[model samples]
Target: MEQLHNKNTHGVVRFITCGSVDDGKSTLIGRLLYDTKAVLTDQIQALTKTKHARVTASDAAIDLALLTDGLEAEREQGITIDVAYRYFSTVKRKFIVADAPGHEQYTRNMVTGASQADVAILLVDATRLDTSKSNISLLAQTKRHAAIVKMLGLKHIAVAVNKIDLLNFDEEVFKKIKEEILNLANTLKLPTPQVFPVSALLGDNIVNPSKNFNWYQGPTLLAWLEGLDISSEKSGVNLRFPVQYVARQDGSAAEDFRGYLGRVESGEIHQGQQVTILPAGSVATVAEIYISNGLNSFGQNTSVEMAKAGDVIALTFSEDVDVSRGDMIIAQDNSSDLLTKQLIADICWLDHDALSTSRKYILRHTTNTVFTKVKNIIQILDIETLSQAVEADSLGVNMIGRVELALQKPIAADLFDESLATGSFVLIDEATNHTVAAGMIREAL
Candidate 1:
């Protein structure tokens, strides 16, 4: 059995499988895991012993979809209900795969998965699409998922034409689906999607090339994913550190030992660097930086001198500044201005209850939480046509729209296009504490 934590030469590629219902997102993930030799012997035995009820006793093939659909409700309904995450590694690269639900009602779950992914593998079931017509239309849920992927700014996209074995490996069908997917990508202004013909159930064109599709000559799905270059794009981003905790010396040993503890969301931080504390407009010099290194004999975190992006560190300032848990520490030379109390944003409504402008909601951005309300709904998006309509007043479940927000206090936030860490936020219902919506800051008003 191949261990999930095996070292790879390249950085981990985080991706999500998403599309319309019955697109074989879970099965595709299972196939990738199985073919990569990531499944343990005991796990494979368990899967073989408890095959799907639909499979006959004579059938020797294991139900691969059972590996990911762990929820009993999901197994009974034969559909994915929540986001399922799995890890596997090859000699060249490591992978973190997310199996996102395809149902329209569970769109929020998909959004949660896509938020952290660098690539998206959208599965299109060939049997579900009508290739006989001149103008083959994709499913409504497929279009919706693509639009959401574009909105979230995913750069790499791939369309896997799944279940091609059912269509007798027809070249014309694959070409038609590929053309329609290209058109959809153009309409949504997404990056040109790389299309491939695959049969997730039969283990064709997944980890290895399939001999059934003689006309097609493209790299296997795993090959393309392993060779993707996403590191350059992640580099050179500006620093956006949201203070999560304020650490101070308990006794008088150090006397004035005060440090701001948080993860460096982007860019890098060094000792003696000048930083600006947001919302308060206080300028301070970094006296010392301490990167967290596990725990010592006393169970206290050991420290180092410098830290970079993705590192959690404690930074002490030269001056005694009024820094709190919600305050943000940014580079003094940062180009964008990120302090504002009013904002215009694009939001996805996730709650069952409709958004009410009169009701007060809690807005949590980075580490800051403030009371907020919907001042006005700018427009509602029509997923099918990709048009914005201004006639709508309230947003319903799984609906994406633009809205203006009025915050009770000013916050440090960059536009979503500028910095994902500082721009994204969630709206929580004050009464029930349920997350009602996810918002991306478009502009500060």
Candidate 2:
């Protein structure tokens, strides 16, 4: 067994915030940061003493919601516009939070944030049960987001039914919302999601237990996040690494060393296992593993014959091999039938211009980038209703579509539902080198 580290180490957790603009995603994040004392003292002072926080005494309550609703339009509309990212740390964990927009128009931004997320916090407005984008029917928005998120491959979620004070602290209302949310989640085949009845305005069910809803009993949002599994193994994936850099002999004890440096993208990587290099197709055993090398990469030389998933280590192969950045390292047994030139993909269209068969973009999968043209818009995914439209001619901005892509060269990737780390890719505008869309591998098409 590997040596256990100290308890005080900060385990990292990245997550996205969901729900409509009114579900208090921004306010909930602010409340979580505030109650945990994660926000700086200067910011906290501004919260209490600043006259700018309020236009009048009626607004003098120091709207914690104002603290994170960063966009001017967001402040005016009282909703999140763009994806607002915030970072903070508690005693047990360090967090990178993406408070994504709740509007249907901003679904692309939400997808960008969802790409790296391990947990999703779905905020539900308790007062208005429906899920509309901007009004009292917020549950409509909640259900829509739930479906999109599950389609986007997020399973672990925390449904924070916030703004409960306006519901008279009634346990029945809370129970009703929780049950509805769970039912929707179950419909999407999402895992058993944790639901927390919270009041971001009053800091209830955020940091500590709430006195407002005395009959309700559950862990607070913070406690749930704290207990969330940050283990790299949770994704249920096999070991794979995309080689980032290759290190060779230097001075001192490193003179005879050769290492393939990269962070493990999924599963476990162990020394002495036969590993294969992609593109060039070379195979060798990991002679040694390294960390703390002269270079500022993740791993160096070591005797770790077996390292679990998510470890970043430098692996020394037995012989000089043609491995470089943009090449993937795979366990010999894990290698399967890799696609060469044709693939069927589900693309989340992020480009302002509509996509058609004639458009050519760079398809980047794992460490390789290849030129490609979309063969067809097979179907557009209706995330809100969970249906597919078979006859769509074009995919507009923020639309999720299943399209046939023909690549200029072969790339290594798996089916999206099979392995998210290696299965997802992005299409870049060859001219501008800007990412135009995100795609998931469905199969060769």
Candidate 3:
């Protein structure tokens, strides 16, 4: 057995397991954690003693699903209701795994988990599918989840035909399922997904290959994950820094010390880099960069020469420009034009109440929030057929649709396909202060 290590040579890979309810999503995650020795002995003992533990003929097997089904309701009902996240690392790579709920009502929860994931491991229950039919119909929940992930721009997808052991590890059944999955992907315009036949319960073809199936010849699920190239698409892009806070040393010895504090959403910022402040359209050079040490009582910050994406730092400009909290800073030379008051976006309706076009919503994108109205409900997407319906005027809860939005003012944003950080926004109900929808900008109209 390979020893588990905390250090990783490759960067972290965030993935989510999603499928219909009772499809063994939780079991697959638990098996990965168990095989990698991520779970402690005490946790294993607790699993065996739990009332929900699965009983075998010889002994009470450790209920691996219990490792991620942490909520009381989840344990009592034996279903994942909310998204549960777990972290584990190997010598090759680090992983952050999310176990998403599979129910139709909780589709919003699954979207939340998939938004941050680099890859999605879609679990399919082999026993529940009928292979005798010429046209195999997948569960509605499965199609919905798959569509949502594709809409979210997840480039990598893997289908795990789970519970293969129930069919006596039959190779023909696995092939049928794999064929259906490919058809589904082609219909959704998604890239070809890597398919695997595995038994999450018995831990076959997950971390290690099983001798039960000699015909199947593919890397184990863990091996494929470890070898994936997780290099960010954001690399080589121009800088995009959204100003969140403005810090000033009023009583310090040095006068005119103004720092714009926020995270570098993309690209890099150097000390002498020339950047343009958006909306205001003012150009200034970066004078100094200070890496924020978080909240300190002494108010001391370490000055740095440069900062890259994912870094939260304070930047000082050469000129005293009128920079505000909601302003964005980008490279002046190569940045794309982004100022626009109208936008076309794809949205996932998340509220209990249906979307109303006349109602006004607070559109929060990055550090900026603006009042906006839904100008038009362009079309509603049919998840089953992957088609668009233009007749719908209103969108119900957990629906995905395209709409045109009219903002109060122009804001700097990129297309969702170009930059997820700047192109995504959430619609908030003004009266209830509840997030009603999550939107991705498709075009600046």
Candidate 4:
């Protein structure tokens, strides 16, 4: 029974807004911030002074897009180019919101934001979906972003049919768009997705229910977000603790003060538990555990009975075992066959320099960086058709592909579907040390 302090803290939910250009990703986020009363007085004053502000006879409205589109170029062009993150909290939950770029050229920026998000809010302009002919589908970016979200393994999705106010809150128009989105979700085999009709610019059906939409009995966007169960999503993972540092004291107490300091990436660790150290294949018993209290600070070294996922803990071992930074501390019962050299992964190319099989790059996972090379370009994914091209020679910027990699050493890792924290990595350019690509492990080869 670990004396774990207040678990009553409201959990943080990381979510992203993505769609085609002019789909209102930035405005949606700005609405969330303002309606929640998270905006400061000065921020409001700055928005009011901007030329882009929209005012009504009865009330005034800021160019809410300016809230997330902070770049001068973005504001001038009225388009988002980079991923913008905003943090706010309600009584029920805290939120870390990301406004992803909606342009086709900035697909890489959207991928970067969606990779860490727990849920995705896919926005669709209601005006686009009001098709007189029944055959045409939604925009290309709408479908492309949905496929990428599924590949990233973000199971929870919220289809927000935005700008419904443009349609005079027409129920028939909302139903048509909802049906089209649901059809797409079924084709992608996406999990149960929730749909909401919203007007981010007008703040309708966002934080508060809209009187204009009397037919909609669904929860508001904020309410649905608050009701999500994030803990269930984190359960059933294996223990993976990557040692960031070895904590040592310099006094008589130092004799017994050999502790491995790191955050628990997944699963639970308990006192008296037998653990295995990777690469070395050594075994040791967990002697005691101490959880961090604050920055550069620690609580009293108490003998915690158990520590679960997301805890930043320092633990001492009963027996001496060789360990250092980059070493993994996994429970003995959870050990699996580790991959030593070759692996197959899904990669999203992020650099101007195309991936070349002839060049050696740096592969970084967790705390380890190793020399690696692209062995084979198996296939390139076509976002439009959601199919693969078997004859790809190289992966271009913003292209998604499957590739085989040869590493200098092995890494203790899991399939991306099984464990997100340990299964993802980045490729770095050896010369410039720039992040060239992001990868999610499919399996060991």
Candidate 5:
């Protein structure tokens, strides 16, 4: 139940970029990092040195995509192959950009990267917009990309129509592509995503305004990113702080000292507040909220008495509670519902072996892991069409399905839409020790 309720805080926004195979996603990421001065001198030199064999038919003095597409094969083929992470921050906010590869087979990487991101940028090549003859396969792939991003819970999406210079900066093409994507977004029931026409290669509308697109009026990508905030603004929600560990001064040093360690997952947790530990249903009042760097009883220096929403703090309890890892603390006031039972969720399959209907795996939710079996694959959404179909017996790689997981014992988790911390789980194949699927909590926890 740990929640990120504050929308105004200077938070780290993780984003994933998805697009057609030739939409310049890697190039766009490189340009964003370069324009922001996030690239260092040594890394820049490394990029220049690799230019000997990294040339494509469309080559530049510096192959910017080399800044992100790190694989040797990818460099030789002039394509992105793996999901690359590029971290940077600006004057206003911090960012973690997951540059996902665009090929159809790499869809699992996109899902993995998408799992941790707050927003998504879908880049499109304006010249190759929805062509029935040339881009038939690409159009189908783009539809799946949008559907998967929505399923992964990206609150805000930005469509950057890249390579406008190739189209002579055509305004009509921009409008037509924008309208087409808008229609598709509406069909997916996703939040109305904003669109920006840009040339990531030419540095137009990326860091600053573009001189070539005089008719384009949308906010520049940088300005838009700076202005945007996390959409999960559910403040005043029920408190959910799951305990990760217990630290104590045992036997001798300071026998009276005891603390429960965990991050603040949800609503505000103040010192000396009443709380109930889940599963055990033990009630206690917080005696002191101890942080990693706690100060003594001096009212001179600055020390936060209370953590707002996202801050992590350790707490000492009034009562001698036997709380351990995987336990949850609920604020006493809002104890309406607590669950420990069967659950359903949307799953992103990752294993090359199909998810057999009768198979069992170790399900990890937060710090708790339990043996679970695939009860059913209730709704299998056609990735290309973005619509649900009849029940399938097995799920393949990169295929997303709404599954009902039957646990050997009841587990404590929240509906993903209700609380992301409690609502997410991963499935590990017991025999091979490989993570086969990533799932989010669904209705009726």
Candidate 6:
């Protein structure tokens, strides 16, 4: 029921770079930060230290990787082991860039990055385009990461053909790579990805135009990113505000000061608006809305006429209604007919142990956790082929599959394509209490 709009007053665009190992993801992010002059003097000075290895041979030059590869272990190995997030701003917009690990073992980390991204930069190494050998080569991680980002619902994808310097900035090589990427996108039914020939290490066609590639006339990566309409991608289609706590101001004068505290995941709520409480459809009118100073530190209760999606506030009802933590308050205008206990979901298995139907796990949706069991593994998707292996019994580490989940209690939810906030859930291991899987509801059973 939330109205979709464009351009948040703050121009922030969140994106991620992912591909095979040694594909220069960290370097690309580092170069973006460096070219934008976002790095500080002390950080630049630290890069000159003997321990920080520079990518180029120049003594005065700094290795851009040092700006992102923060961990000691990652620096020693010269690889990104986890998701490295860096914030910077250009003249046109602010940016949050996530440099995801390229190794196949860290696919879960890539998924974490993809979950929050509005756009994705799929990096491809120029050297990996070699096709003269008898055996054809494919970057498995690149394909896998592409599938993961697409599956996670990112519509804007940019294919950066990196390391063009190594190929002498060959126009034909760029064409070949671009064509191959287009073919792959077509096979996956993904939106057409804009291709750019870039050298993250050499700083070509990233923040500035590359003089080397005369044939390339499109906007630079930064320019393209600045031009994107990311406002519509910030929130989902439905209103979902899950109550985290209930604040009661008990006093002789403030007798009517009882409020439900929560962050609006999506959609907006207004004062005197009619709202429905979910899992128990009780209707109530919002008497007052108060924006708190902090999550726990509620110093000043600033009364507001309305609260938009993403605002953390408290709602006082006109009529005293029984509401508690884990309950949801949604707009009464939600049109989805879905209200069920069984769901068909697409899941990314993150646990070391495979997923089994017989085992019970805790399914956490919004703030509510309930017992759940995997009733059946319908199919496992092959990332490269874009084909499903029908009738899979279980899912292994990093494998993506569609399964039937039986919940102990019924929930008011929506299709993932309808609303991401209400249609997603996480599977937690009973024994280790670790998040073993992340899932998106495809449909109700």
lDDT of 3 by residue, 1-445 (tens): 0011123437788899999999999989999999999999999988988987653624227878999999989998889999999999988988999999998888888988988888899999999998888778888788888888887888778999998888999998888889999999998888799999998888899999999778899989999999887666534347889999988877655675788888888878898989999988899999888876767221235567888777778888888799999999999885567888999999999998999988899999989999999999999988777789997899998899999999999899888877878878889999999989988999997
Candidate 2 weakest lDDT stretch, 10 residues: 1-10
| lDDT for position 151 in model 5 | 73
Model 4, residue 265: what's the lDDT? 83
Query: Which regions in candidate 2 have their CA more than 4 angstroms from the true location?
Result: 1-11, 49-60, 66-82, 87-94, 128-144, 230-237, 246-259, 270-272, 292-308
- Which regions of candidate 6 fall more than 4 Å away from where they truly are? 1-5, 8-10, 52-60, 133-137, 233-238, 298-301, 335-338
What TM-score goes with each of the models? 0.93, 0.82, 0.94, 0.89, 0.88, 0.94
Instruction: Please list the C-alpha lDDT of all candidates, in the order they appear.
Output: 0.85, 0.74, 0.86, 0.84, 0.77, 0.83
**Candidate 2 Cα RMSD after full superposition onto the native fold (Å):** 4.7
Q: What lDDT does candidate 1 reach at residue 121?
A: 95
Clashing pairs in 1: none
lDDT of 1: 0.85
Error of 5 at 64 (Å): 1.2
Q: Candidate 3: where are CA atoms >4 Å away? A: 1-9, 54-60, 234-236, 252-256, 294-301
Full candidate order by TM-score, most accurate first? 3, 6, 1, 4, 5, 2
Candidate 2: Cα lDDT at 435: 77
lDDT of 5 by residue, 1-445 (tens): 2333555647777788898788888888888899899999898887777754443536355667888887878888777778999998889888889988888887878877877778899988877765334223337667778888877666789999898888888887777787888887887888898898898777889888988889988789878887886757433347777787787766875556677777776777777789888777788988777555544222212334665556566778778879988788888886656655678888888889999877789998876788998888898878667778875888998788898878886666677776777778889999999989988877655
Instruction: Report the lDDT tens digits of candidate 6 across residue range 100-150.
Output: 999888888888888878889999998876745433345878888877876
TM-score, prediction 4: 0.89
Clash count per candidate: 0, 20, 0, 0, 4, 0
Model 3, C-alpha of 187: deviation from truth (Å):
0.8
lDDT digits (tens) for residues 302-412 of candidate 1: 455567777778888888889999998888997356789999999999999999999899999999999999999999989878788996889999999999999999999
Across residues 1-445, which tens digit of lDDT does each residue of candidate 2 receive? 0111122334677788988767778878887777777777787777676544532334225667666777777777777778888888888888888989988778777888887787799988877675332322234556667766776677568888887777778787777777777667766688888988888778888889988878877788888888775543335446678887777777786477767777677667766789877766778888877654445654442466666545667788877788877788877886766546788877778778778678789888776788899877888867556568898889887777788888887777767776776778899988888778888787853
